[model samples]
Target: AQELLTKISEKCFKKCIAKPSSSLDSSEQKCIAMCMDRYMDSWNLVSKAYSSRIQ
Candidate 1:
């Protein structure tokens, strides 16, 4: 979970954030939300496949 969050934050920050700021704007928030969801979905899919293969 921590890894997933970290990865999502890093990727989303790079993709969604342009300049460093004290707080995120509405659009940045939405972008980060969408990015996190997509990353989580991909992570879950890969994890499922990896577990199946290991078993």
Candidate 2:
């Protein structure tokens, strides 16, 4: 979870935050939220597949 969160933070920061500011704007927040959700879904899917294969 830590590793995944770190990756999601980096990816969302690059993709959503166009300019560094005092804080994230509403749009940036929304974009990051959506990106994180998608990343988490993908991660979960991959993890399940890998675990199933190992078993």
Q: Give me the displacement of residue 31 in model 2, in angstroms.
A: 0.4
lDDT string for model 1 (1-55, tens) is 7887788889999989989799989999999999889888988899999999999
Q: For model 1, how big is the CA root-mean-square deviation?
A: 1.9
* TM-score, prediction 2: 0.75
Residues 1-55 of candidate 2: C-alpha lDDT, one tens digit per residue: 6888899999989989988999889999999999999988998999999999999
The lDDT of each candidate is 0.90, 0.93
What is the alpha-carbon lDDT of model 1 when measured against the actual structure?
A: 0.90
How many clashes (backbone N, Cα, C below 3 Å) per candidate? 0, 0
In model 1, which range of ten residues has the least summed lDDT? 1-10
Off by over 4 Å in 2: none
In order of appearance, the predictions have TM-scores of 0.73, 0.75
